[model samples]
Target: MAIDPKYLMESYANPIDYWELFSKSGLSKFPPCVVSVAITGGNQGKESNPNLPETLDEQVQQTYDAYKEGASLVHIHCRCPHDPSTVTDDPEVYRELNRRIRKKCPDIIINNTVIGGKWSRNGVMCPPMNVSIPARPEVGSVDITNYTWSMMRKGRPEYGRPQDTLEEMQYTINKQELEHTLSEMKKYGVKPEFELFDIGDLQYLRDLIQEGKTDPNVPNWVQMVFTPALTYQTPDMLLAAIRHMPKNTVLGIVATGGCQYPFLALALILGCNVRVGMEDGYYVEKGVLAESNAQLVAKIVRIAKELGRPIATPAQAREILGLGAPRMEF
Candidate 1:
């Protein structure tokens, strides 16, 4: 059988497409890696890791430290001012935080979470989902699939419950929420950092793109979230996930808890970007809690340097991700 000339040429469309070339040419040809740090997440707070930043001042300072250490992007989850344990829905909180982060790290890409804490009982999505875009993030994380999740954790004092008591949340992110999220992101020019937990999420996002629901010109920024509950983090699963992504996708990898380091290293070696920080995991190593988000950023920087992959600066990251100037200035 004769091979087609069209199949013989190299066409770099997505991160995974580099696999064959990388095998033959080696790491010298790899592009600069974008390191995004989730300084704080909506879930977990000082209780989980005493050093985790839950206040405005702490978050800003931690983010600045990470930025200085080579993190080109930061994922933000602003905590309620009054109750520092729970995540806030108030756009003011988000806006204020973004403004401060901008002042400290002027060029770093600002990303806000779309999913916020629900009333511990009902599963309806609230607050930040509607307000994240209004707060004007350059990127908004949207979980593209609909799923139900239930988890129990130590109750926070702010929840009016005993610290030892286990509080549970059984929530669902459905189609209605997904549609609302996509619409808001489109309106604000916020790039959708689609969080893919499973292969179905990838398929759903591809359908959205095919149906013209997503902006074709904008790069599909995907973060493959690996966790015990969502998608099992394994080398084969990671490879399969990347292989199924649509062309023109910019891939980022993140894993919860213990899987963090190995997957992050794998992401770099595979020519994909990476996301780190306290949001994904609070530890710098096994049983060793990271004192600050910057510590994790510094560790990843060291890994990238060791692998001969240069870390992208904010300007370089913006260009690599095809993002324009800040959508809305504070």
Candidate 2:
């Protein structure tokens, strides 16, 4: 008997099938985009947003809620009770946070952030200093360019300072620094989530991949961080990133302010994954505060659905990212 087109079309579930359909239709390639919720804003806490997760229980609950709302991955930034504004290098906090979150949502991909900052009383926030991966989570971020990471400059008051007016640390991701983070991550088999701040950062990542520093066995996850200070947020800048984007690697974005809503829409059209939630921006709209991370994730899930793109399960996300079998479920 001849095959039924309806049956064939209805049975398609994976990203490749959708990709083929989009290509055949001559539309912009749209694939299943993985949703990653950055559980907490870098320094935001209850004091500022009141909705920010600071306590261990709150963090775990928020993460679980986000996962249930179709977020397959979570960017885990261990919280410290002392001050919700600065990151804690203490290994205990990282270990506890990772353990609890993993237990809470086994299938949800965990990506730990390695960042530190010195809060200046005078309002000139120092670049996040002493950045380290205290927790050996599934993945950690690796900055690959020279730039400043100021939430203020990006229209997000992470440091709660005036944008571009206060001085911040100039984060230079030199070879030595990259190697150090790599060494630390290797100790725990943690994959590096290389961040692209500009087009050059992409080229640098290419060099590392060629040098065997970034082994191909592990799925490379590159996050494009758009910022005014870095000058890599425009369509032309995105073109530059895709121009040098590495082969067979995951491409995602962390657009700050309310930019994620629009930028994610564009990135999805181009078949790129996404990162959202309070870490990037707390606004569900211009003046409103996000009640929870799940709210942000659901927004993206809805958009992808309307665009005729299926959502990937936790296991599929793991497989797409080349994460190991069994333990890392879909």
Best by TM-score: 1
TM-score, one value per model: 0.89, 0.81
Cα lDDT of model 1 by residue, 174-254, tens digit = 666777777877787778888877877778878878888777665678888888777888898887887777766778888
What is the lDDT of every predicted structure here? 0.77, 0.68
Which residue window of length 10 is worst by lDDT in model 2? Answer: 2-11
Candidate 2 clashing pairs?
Answer: 116-128, 116-129, 117-128, 127-169, 314-330, 315-329, 315-330
lDDT of 2 by residue, 42-149 (tens): 555554477878777888999999999999888866555665565565667767777888888887878877632224423545434234354567777766676644
Candidate 2 regions off by >4 Å? 1-30, 115-134, 149-167, 326-330
**Each model's Cα RMSD:** 4.9, 6.8
lDDT of prediction 2: 0.68
Candidate maximizing lDDT: 1
The TM-score of predicted model 1 comes to: 0.89
